[model samples]
Target: MDAVQGLETGDTFILHATFKPVPLFAVMKAKGFTYESEQLDKKHWKVTFVKRGLGQ
Candidate 1:
């Protein structure tokens, strides 16, 4: 979570959490980030979200 605080201007990060999906998106949104997610390898879901704090 601490890494979330130091997000660069236009950096993107991949985050993993428990076996839930909706809540993860909710949390990322609440933290001022836009995100997209998909299931990875059919085993688990991988979420790819972007932090739009700044730009290049």
Candidate 2:
């Protein structure tokens, strides 16, 4: 929730995690954010979350 709280409309953030945060992606999508995830190596994931024009 901190990530979401830190962002405003049209803001973007890159989350780098040790594993793919599939659940987080789903939750964010449900909240009307857009995202793309890329797996780097076996233990790294880069997820870009964007707060688009959503009422939140």
Top candidate, metric lDDT: 2
Candidate 2: what lDDT?
0.86
lDDT of 2 by residue, 1-56 (tens): 87677677888889999999988888888777899999997999999999878464
Q: Show where candidate 2 strays beyond 4 Å.
A: none
Clashing residue pairs in candidate 1, if any?
Answer: none
Q: Supply candidate 1's per-residue lDDT for 48.
A: 77
Candidate 1 lDDT over residue span 1-56, tens digit each: 78778886467888665444786677877777888777665557677778876431
True lDDT of residue 16, candidate 1: 66
Best by TM-score: 2
Q: Candidate 1 has what TM-score?
A: 0.68
For model 2, name the residue pairs that clash. none
RMSD of model 1, in Å?
3.0
Candidate 2 weakest lDDT stretch, 10 residues: 1-10
Residue 32 in model 1: lDDT? 78
